[model samples]
Target: MKRTVLPFVLLLAAACGPRYGMRVPDKLVEKLPYESRIELLESENDLALAIDTVDEASNEVLRARDAIRRAKARESAAEEEENRAADTASREVAKLAIEEARARVTYLRAKQRLNVGLRDVEQLALRCAFARYELARLQSTRKAKVEGSEKLDVKKYEGQVSQCEAKVKEERAELAEDSAQEKTAREAWEVKKAALAKKTFDARASPYVENL
Candidate 1:
């Protein structure tokens, strides 16, 4: 039993000795060199990624600023275009207003002239009616006085009455025509005046704020 125990203890001591011999000394070994290199490489890689992120963010900011500038420029251009359009519209409206006013004045003048002519025709018709009535009364009295006494004179007077009647008829027709023409002229003037007045009101109330 003693011999067996001694041999086993010697074998255990030999195994422990070889195991201790396989380990390197602390002073001779490169301590944690691979781990330290990996750590430094990882830190440099992180810095490169951070720089790339910053560059991308700066590019985005520049793009946004450029877009904002373009938007403002477009807005300014649109405003200028609107103002130009308004100015053009104002000029056109003024020209139209002037033309309409001239037309209205001309129509009014024509209406006044027609009215004066109509009054003259009416007075002429009145004079013609009075003359025809007096001629008719003279013919009736001459016929009652004598049938054969100066028959030629009676025929002459009858012819004069017929001529006077024709004249009165012509005067009445002319007066009716003149009255109709006067009414048409008056209606035309009123229409033009109304249209011009409405246009003036619209111009005053418009957003452009310019008189036409």
Candidate 2:
């Protein structure tokens, strides 16, 4: 009876050991699934870090482009300002040149008037000299006639004196007329010259007064 009972107990123990070994293999398979999930999560995190780095690089590039654009705008504005200044300076120079030309013209006109007046005075003086010479000749002949000069041709001398006196009177009237004309011309010239002088002075002083 003891030998038969020992054999039956050994068979039962063998059956229970097979069942427990099967459960251990199943648990190891479950742990493998969890390890695979953890690996997948790590890969996703690495992909996100790569994307973030790319975004940062793109932002830097955009910032550099904006800086370049701003610098170009500033340069263009400076160029425009310089151009405006140059245009203004050119206009000022043109105005000054025109003023100088006008001044020169006024001076020339004044000089011409003075020259005309001087010429007229000279002509009047010449005419007066001629008149005085003719009067002297007529007086000499009349005095000779009154002194009874017998050798001299009386009719011829008297006729010559009369002709000379007439010539003297005509020359005197012409001289008087010329003198009056000359006086008028001189007065007009003086007035014009004074005006011209004032214009020249003003033109020369304008730059100083304007502080140009």
Please, what is the TM-score per model?
0.33, 0.25
Q: For every candidate structure, what is the RMSD over all alpha carbons to the true structure, in angstroms?
A: 60.5, 64.9
Worst 10 residues of 2 by lDDT: 19-28
Give each model's whole-structure lDDT. 0.42, 0.39
Off by over 4 Å in 1: 1-100, 139-158, 168-191, 200-212
Winner by lDDT: 1
Predicted structure 1, TM vs. truth: 0.33
Candidate 2 local lDDT, 49-102, one digit each (tens): 433444454554455455445434534543444455556754444343334333
Give me the displacement of residue 65 in model 1, in angstroms. 73
**Candidate 1 local lDDT, 53-99, one digit each (tens):** 44454554455455445434544543454455556755454444444
Clashing residue pairs, backbone N/CA/C < 3 A, model 2: none
Candidate 2 residue runs with Cα over 4 Å from true position: 1-151, 202-212
